[model samples]
Target: MNSPLPPLEAPTQSAMPEAMNPSPDRVYIGFDLGGTKMMAAVFDAEFNILSRRRRKTRGNEGQKAGLERIGETIDLALEEAKVTHDRLAAIGVGCPGPLDLDKGIIFDAPNLGWKNVAIREFLEKRYNSPARIANDVDAGVYGEYSFGAGKGARCVLGVFPGTGIGGGCVYEGKIIRGTKSSCMEIGHVQVLRDGPRCGCGLRGCVEGVASRLAISAAAAAAVYRGQAPKLAALVGTDLKEIRSSALAEAIKEGDTVIEEIIKDACKHIGVAVGAVIHLLSPDVIVLGGGLVEAMPKLFVGEVKDAARKNVMDTYRDTFKVVAAKLGDDATALGAAAWAVASLQPA
Candidate 1:
C-alpha cells in the first residue's frame, strides 16, 4: 500500500531530492480515457507533468479505432515531452466500465460500446513497459488520497456525481478493490424503492435520483412547468445545455426550485455516504466531479448535514466531508502514481 511518489500539494509543485529522481531513461505515462474525451500525460520520476495531449474520444468510431487513438495520443504526449519510446518506464490507464482487474480487460464500456478490450496488453505490447489499469473512480479516489483533499486520512471514500454517480475508496494508501474486479459501487445502492429507474435498469438507485443527469432531467421538467424561469431563460428545456455551471448559475439567479432540486440530490448522496460510513468507518469522505466542483459549498454542506443526521450518533462525528481538489486530473494522476507503486521491487 506504500506510495512511490511523495505527497504533493495538488495544483502546486515542489522540488524533490536528486537521489529520489529516476534516471533520464525512465519516464511514465498516465492516461484518462473518458466517455467524451481522452487525455494523455507524460510525467517525470517525481510525478511532475512534463507534457500532455488531449482529443475527443469519438467512441462511436468503435473499439479498434478508439484503441488506436489512445496509442496515438500517448505517442504525441511523449513526443511533446521530448522523450523517446525507449525512455518510457511504465504506463497507467483509468477507464470506465466493469473491468477484470486480474486480466486488465474492460468487460464493457457502455458509453464507448467496447467490450473485452485488452487495454493492458495493448499498452504493454505497444510501449514495451509495465502497464496498470484501474477503474476511473478508483484512480480518482487514490489521487485524492495521495495528493489532494483526502491527504493525511487513514481512509477516504470518494463519491463523484456526473452523468452518473461513482464511488471508490482508498485505505492506507491503496485502492480498496476485489481480487478480480473493482468494488464500491455506491451509486447503484438503492435509496428509494420504486422511485426512478436507473440506467442499470434498477429502481430507486441513488444515481437515478442524484446524478447530474438526473438533476438536469428534473431541471428541464421544471423549466417546462414554469417552475424554474431563471433556468429556462439560460438553457430552456434542452438537457444537453443544462450543464453543471448552468445549474449553478440558475441557483445564483434566485431559482429557488432549482436549488431545492440540487439540495434534494445532495441529500440522497448523503444518505448513501451514511451507509458507507457504517460499513467502512472512513475518516474522510470526498465529494468530487462536475456537479460538486460547480457547487462545493452547497454539496458539502447539504451532504454533510444529511449524512450526520442519518448515521448513528456515535458515527456522526467520526468523519469529515470535503470537496475534491484535483478536478479533471485526479484519475490520470492516480493511475500514474499507481503504476509507479506497482513497479517498485518487492
Candidate 2:
C-alpha cells in the first residue's frame, strides 16, 4: 500500500461542472424515546449535532399524546437547526422496542404505554422524508461503534443498564437484525432461576436483577430497614428519586450496603455479557447508560472481572471492555447515522 502517494485536484468542468450544486448538505433527525425522557436531535452529514430538544415521556397521557410529543420534539429540533422540514433527508427513532422493523411498528414499550405504534409512517408523513426505527440500546451501541468508544473495531457489542438493560451489536459494519425481526433483548435474558419478577412478566431475568430499577428497589428496601442511612438522607425512600447520582454520593460517603448492591448488579450484568461474548465473540464490549456513567470504575471493574472469570481462557484477552464515551447523545446520534446509511445506495 502507498502512503501519501498522490494529491487530488478539483473536478474539471467538462467532467463534472455541477458537482457542488448537485445537492444540499443532508441533515437527519434522530429521536430517543425512553421511559423517563424523550430527546430529539438534528445532525449534519458527519453526525455533528446541530440542535436538540428534550422532555419527559409522561406516558400516562396515552399513546396519542406520546406520538404528538415525538413530532413536536422533532419539529423544534429542526427549527433550531434552521433546516426546514422539506430539506430533511431522513429521520430515525431509537425507542424502547421489540419492533416489527420491516414496517417500523413498535410491538410494546411498557415504559411508554405504547403498543403497535407505526412510528416510521408517522415520521415520514409528518416530515415528508424516509424514516427508520431500532431498539434504543441498539441505536446507542451503533452510535458508539460508528462515532464513539467502539470505533475502528470490526465488531462491537453494547450492553446499557438503565431503567432496563438494553443491548445491541454492530457486526462487520452493519447492524445485526434477525430474519423475522430485530432481536437482541439482552436485558431480558435469564440471570437467575425463580428470582424476582421482571417488567416483562418474566422471572429471574437480568433486568429483574441488575437494572437501575432493581438497584433502586434494593436501595429502597435497605433504607426502609435503616441499613442505608446515607441513601435515605440523600434521596429519601422514594425509588423514583434514588437515581445513579444519588447512589454515587452514597458510595462516596462509604455506604457499604449501596456499594454492595451496585457491585452485585454489576456481577449479574457481567454474567450476561460473558454469555454474549461466548456466543458472539465481538471485538469490543461497550458499557453505557446513566448507571455506568455515574460509577464507571466500579461498574467496569466488576463487569470485567466477572466476565473474565466466566469466559474461556483462550478468549480471555481478545475483547476490551470499556464504558460508553458519548454520554447522553449516543442513541440519538446513532439513529441519525443509521438513517443516513439506510438511504445510501448499495
Candidate 3:
C-alpha cells in the first residue's frame, strides 16, 4: 500500500522539527473511507489532532465525484489544521475491500458502488507524499492495539458488526495482509450451510447472518407480521432508522420479536468468534462498531458466552472478548501511524 516518495523536495525546521521531520515534515494525514461517509484528519507527529473533516460518501454520484469529495475533505482538514502540502509527511487511507493493496486499487466496494480505484496513487500525486491503504477494520484494530482497548496485546482479533461484519487481525505488531490485499476476511467465513445472501454476493457468510443488515431484515419481517409492536411504533418498518440505538430501545421496551431477532444475530456472531478463537488463538477479541457501541453488554456478553461454549476446553479461557474503546478516531489514528512507519525516509 505504499510507494517511495519523490524524496523531500524541501525541509523546513521552523514548520517541522528536525528529528520528527526527517522524511518530509512532521505532519501526517489519515483518511477513513466508509460505505456511508468519508473522513479526513490531520495529526502532528505525536498523533495529536490538528483538524478533521467529514462528509457523506455520495457514492451514487459515481467514482469520479466520490474521489473529488474525498480530496476536498482532505484539503479542508489540512487547511483547518493550518498546514499545507509543504508540511505533509505521509498519508494513509482506511478503505473497504477486497483491494489490491500493492497497487492501491480497490477491487470492489459494494457499499460505495466502486471498482478498481487507484486511491493511493491519487493521494500521493495530489499531496506529494508517500501514501498507504488499509482495510477499514484492519486500521481500526491496529488503532486499538496501539492506543485503545487492545493495547499491549500481542495478538488481537477485531470484529466490527455494522451494516456488515468486518473482521481484522493484528499479530505481533503487523496487521495481517496478503501479498495483494489485506487478509482475514472473517465476515465472509461461512457460518451457515444455507443462509442469508451477503453483500459480497455469497451465501451463508457470517456477515449475511450476523450483521446489522441481517438484524434489520428480521425486524422488518417481524413488523410486517405485526409481531413487534414496540419496534413498529418506534421505527415504523423503516430499516434505515432501525439503527443500533433503535434496536436497544426496542429491547428496553421488552419487544419479544425484536429480542429474538437480536439473539439469533448474536448467536451467529458467537459461532464465528469461536471459530476465529480456535484458528488464531488471539489474546483478545475486540468487538466494535455501531451495534456494540449501542448495546455493549448484551452483544459482548452473548457473543463471549457462546464463543466460549463453542471452543475446546483448553482454548475457552484463553482470550477475552471486549468492546472497542477508541470510537471515531481509531481508524484515522491507526492509518496515520501505519503510514508514518511504512513510508521511507527521504
Candidate 4:
C-alpha cells in the first residue's frame, strides 16, 4: 500500500539563499511514476526542492485517465511552488518497467497495466517544455551518485528489492545504458538454475528468490507453519499484510526465524552483487527500496558479508555496500537532476 502524502505547504526557508537561487524562470519539474503511486516535485536550478504533490496511480482507471492524473499532479506541484508553467525550464520523469529510452516511452509496466506510454511527449505537449525520461531505478542511482549515499564515488551500483528487484549503474557520473534501453537488470540474472519461477517467467532469477514479495511469501509460510508467532500475531498469514516494516517489527520482537528469512534473501541479492563486482567493480553498491529502508542494518551487513564472501579475495575491500539516504525523494530529485545534466551542451 502507498504511504499517506505529506500535507502541502509553501516553499520553506531552508530553500537556497536569494543570491544562490536561480532566476525565477529557471525551474525544473521531476516526476516519479511508480506502480502504486506517483509524485511530482518542483526544483530550482540549484536542485533545492520547492514543492511536491503525491497521488495514487489508480492504474485501473486506464491509460488516458492515468495520463490526466499525472498532469494534474504536476500542476498541483507547480501551483504549490508558486511557479507558473511559463517559468519551467524543462521536465524529467523517472518511470518503471521496460522502456524505449531513445524514444522516451515506457514500453511496458505490468504492475500499472500501462504500455507504450509516451510520457515525454505528454509532458512536453502539456507544459510546452523540454522533457526527458529514464528508468526509475537509473534515476534513483543517479540521485545517490549525485547527492546521497554514493556521492564522490567513481562508480555506483544501485539495487532495489521491492515488489520486484530493480538495478541501475552510474559510471563516471553518467548512468550506464545500452544503445536504446536501460541495462543492469540484476534481478533478472539467474541465481539458481531451474529454481522457482519469477514473475518474468524465468526460473531461479534473483528477483524470484530475493525480492520483497518473495521474502513476504516465505515469511507468510513461516506464519502458517506456526514458526513466526510474533509475525502471525501482528499480521496473520495474509501475504498482503506482511509488509516490510511489519517484518522488521517481527524481527525486533525476537522472531529469529523471520530474521533468518530476511538474511537468506539478502544473501541471494549479495550473490548477484558479487557477480556485478566481477564486471563493473563499482566503488559503492547502494541498497535501496522499502525492504532495505525498514531493515537497513541487517540488509547492509548481510549483503556486505555475502558479497565479500562470494567474490575473489583480491577484489575484497574494493567496494562499500551502503543504504540509500534520499528515501522517497530519490527518484524525483534524480530525474530533475538528470534533466539538467542531460540538457547541458556537450
Worst 10-residue lDDT window, candidate 2: 13-22
Residue 212, model 1: lDDT of: 93
- Once fitted onto the true fold, the runs of candidate 2 whose alpha carbons sit more than 4 angstroms away are 1-24
Of candidates 3 and 2, the better by TM-score:
3
lDDT of 2 by residue, 1-346 (tens): 6688577886443321111111468788888988889999998766789999998889889888889888998888888889877567768788785788767888888777889888887877777677888778888998999899999899899998988888899998888988645777788888898989998899999999999999999999999999999999998899999999999999899789999999999888888888888998988989998999999999988999988888999789889889999988998998878877776766
Report model 4's TM-score to 2 decimal places: 0.91
How many clashes (backbone N, Cα, C below 3 Å) per candidate?
A: 0, 0, 0, 0
- TM-score for predicted model 3 compared with the true structure: 0.88
Off by over 4 Å in 3: 1-20, 23-25, 344-346
lDDT of all predictions: 0.90, 0.85, 0.85, 0.90
65-168 per-residue lDDT for model 1 (tens digits): 99999999999999999999877877889999989975679999999999999998888888877788999999999889988999979999999999889999
lDDT per residue, candidate 3, 1-346, as tens digits?
6897788777542222223346434799989998888899998877888999999998899998888888999999988999978778878899986888767788898888999898887887787677888888899999899888899898999999987788899898789988888988888888898876787798999889788988998898898899988888888888888888888898899888787787788888888888988888998999999999998998888889888988999998999989999899999888888777665454
Off by over 4 Å in 4: 1-25
Error of 2 at 237 (Å): 3.3
lDDT of 2: 0.85
Ten contiguous residues with the weakest lDDT in model 3:
12-21
Residue clash pairs of candidate 1 = none
lDDT of 3 at 206: 88
Badly placed stretches (over 4 Å) of model 1 are 1-25
